[model samples]
Target: MSDASTPEERLAALDLAVPEVATPVASYVPAVRSGDHVFTSGQLPMRYGELLLTGKVGAQVGLEEAQRCAQQCALNAIAAVRSVIGDLTRVRRVVKVVVFVASTPDFTGQPQVANGASELFGQAFGDAGVHARSAVGVPVLPLDAPVEVELVVEVD
Candidate 1:
């Protein structure tokens, strides 16, 4: 468990900040709340309106860079969730996470890359952040981003 008192504090301890929610490139909203849960759309590894990394993992992008991209995507997902909930403390549990990695056909490190997002959540929310997850390798992602992430969280 994190020593920090709150999710924001834990993220700060990791040298990360919840970035502003990125404008959806399409017609879809960033996130929506239904009942006690919030579901976030796929979030790219964009920082300041630009993709943090491009190309497939095991090609132009490496494993570590892809992992960083996953972390950025998770950060964006958090921002999306907060946009709907207004308060991060309202989160009860991180229900699920889905990570997509653009990678070469032979590449097989998707799970390790997903750990970047998972670890960040664990640090930020402690036990509440532990959740089921899926890591998938894809031919490409929107904007050629190295990674993308989506989240589902139960809220108070």
Candidate 2:
């Protein structure tokens, strides 16, 4: 996969398109490249400029819906990464992913929820996408989004 085609082509193969990087909701930029790494800011499950799901998982939101939301967050993060790096093909590997799920106090399926993002990365990058990850249950998220994801990638 080291010689894989441009990321836009890879995403097109999956019937996906990198979105225009969502406008930042606050003071932070969407991503930054430092040396050999690109760090994406936390990305909400927003599409077409709207939050797709909201509320705490295991409560107002169901596990399945939250999982899907996580996928959208991952896609948004990739868009953010691309905005900074200029091309997904520049990514050498996904180093780490951090997914935050807003949850009821009893919800313990954070890891499963996070797989939504992991699976997408796998589909897009194959072995290069496998990454160290953290799935955390949080009290709430900005815009009341059910999930958010951020990425740390090593780039050429």
Candidate 3:
């Protein structure tokens, strides 16, 4: 029940295998470090450059599945961070998370869906997980993913 683990220890304890970095489909980089902070581009629910699911949340994709997609986005963000810092422990704290959910016009549970990513961060970074976050409903996302997540983290 306790997601308490130092960043490095969490990687080892959870077998936090970092996935391959997702390629950028545009001019933006996956992540960028400035001073003690790293900001990542919005990561879609992708695996190997392919979207895992596409469509509007609460319609073709259920909230549960969208939650899973959000988790995957978190995983992708972690991978991006590791690509730069080489170690998860270098992360000091998750500063912010912006989760965008492609939603049906009437959907209003974006925050709960974004909790998927927020919870993952808590599990992976413990106290460092507390962060400013925004869960916004959008008309669409690139590649039509149900959810996309971007992170801002402070690192050593």
Candidate 4:
């Protein structure tokens, strides 16, 4: 089996640093592993208990900023994984991702915005980063945050 050190080294080589875990907004666990898969709870664009950005995507929040929020959500997901397994390198593959964009009524660029999280995973894990995904636009999110992301990872 590949060791955590290998992936950690790879992340360092790629100049990637996993951000600290975001605190849960309510009363749900961040991640739960069953057999070989880890299911992460929805992650918002929060830093230090505060939403990084508010309002709907494509309205008050620009696409670029929403994309950045997506990236932050990915970071938060990784932190949840680490909290459960003790090391991100133990993640064999990212199985799936669901990205939700709190969007304006006419916004239709959900997939493009979700690429922010997808790209970050690719940068951090290379081939293992690729995964099935769903990007959907909604009218609102918890705390009126711009974006939220959740992940399912296959680990050993």
Candidate 5:
């Protein structure tokens, strides 16, 4: 993709489609904007309202699979951001990202898995997608998803 391309076009160049905003699982909304920032709730690797994979990484799942799951989580997060702002081009910066990896007792590669989301942001937003991030290993996540991610972005 070229610098002239928009984020949406960059996504298509990667053969990734930004799905419709997922239905909220509970009481909270997908995202909310405050001041110049928009915060998105945790996004599971769900497509068409169903989880793509459900298991604990390093146990029922493997590292590579978990990485793909993380990518999907980021894709979903992007969709959430668009659902609020109408266009991803409105984003001037991706300020922060948090990823939760459901893992067994021995998994120590949460950062690599989380890079799945981070790298995609870099691809879609270039320097703008560079951001602070946290990758945490957890006992479980909602709906037994292998990975979950959330983001905070600065919009135009």
Candidate 6:
């Protein structure tokens, strides 16, 4: 129940802000815009320069924690998007999202974990947040983070 109208205000209503774009841990840039679309590199659950959690889901990490990590990853992806577009309001649609969860081989809840990111997008962009998504389980991710997320967005 937020009266907030803009994306930044909506984030603030949740006690969050589009954080500073995370420093790339490797050679790749955070985001790139080509024509009307922006593609973001994979983003981990980093905060204040440290990962929120480091472990494989279902082994050392639980579902709830993994979901939280996923949310952070999406937030980082949002920051990456902002870096390129300079304005969240410019986003016309979130075209696609890919969530990667580092998990035990037995883990089959990748989709549930990805809901963390999807829900955040809904809160951030409302109807435009609806998008195709793929949730994949992996043995490991960069920096050993529990979750990573990337986005493809169409902008005005």
TM-score of 4: 0.91
**lDDT by residue for model 6 (16-91), tens:** 8888999999999999999999999999999989999999999999999999998998899999999998889899
Global CA lDDT of candidate 5, please? 0.93
What would the TM-scores of all predictions be? 0.97, 0.94, 0.91, 0.91, 0.97, 0.97
What C-alpha lDDT do the candidate models reach, one value each? 0.93, 0.90, 0.88, 0.87, 0.93, 0.93
Q: Rank the candidates by TM-score, best first.
A: 5, 1, 6, 2, 3, 4
Itemize residue pairs with steric clashes in candidate 6.
Answer: none
Provide the lDDT at 94 for model 3: 97
TM-score for candidate 2, please give it.
0.94
* Weakest ten-residue segment in model 5 by summed lDDT: 1-10
- The stretch of ten residues in a row with the least summed lDDT in candidate 6 is 1-10
Residues 41-116, candidate 1, lDDT per residue (tens digit)? 9999989999988899999999999889999999999999999999898899999999999999999999999998
Write one digit per residue (lDDT tens) for candidate 4, span 91-120: 889999999999998899999889999988
Summed backbone clashes in each candidate are 0, 0, 0, 0, 0, 0
Local lDDT at 132 for model 6: 99
lDDT of 3 by residue, 77-140 (tens): 9889988888887888999999999999999999999999998898788888889999999999
Show pairs that collide, candidate 4: none
Cand. 2 Cα-lDDT: 0.90
lDDT of 6: 0.93
**lDDT score of residue 20 within candidate 1:** 96
Query: Listing every candidate in turn, what is its Cα RMSD in Å to the true structure after a full C-alpha superposition?
Result: 1.2, 1.5, 2.3, 2.6, 0.8, 1.3
Candidate 1's C-alpha runs over 4 A off are: 1-4
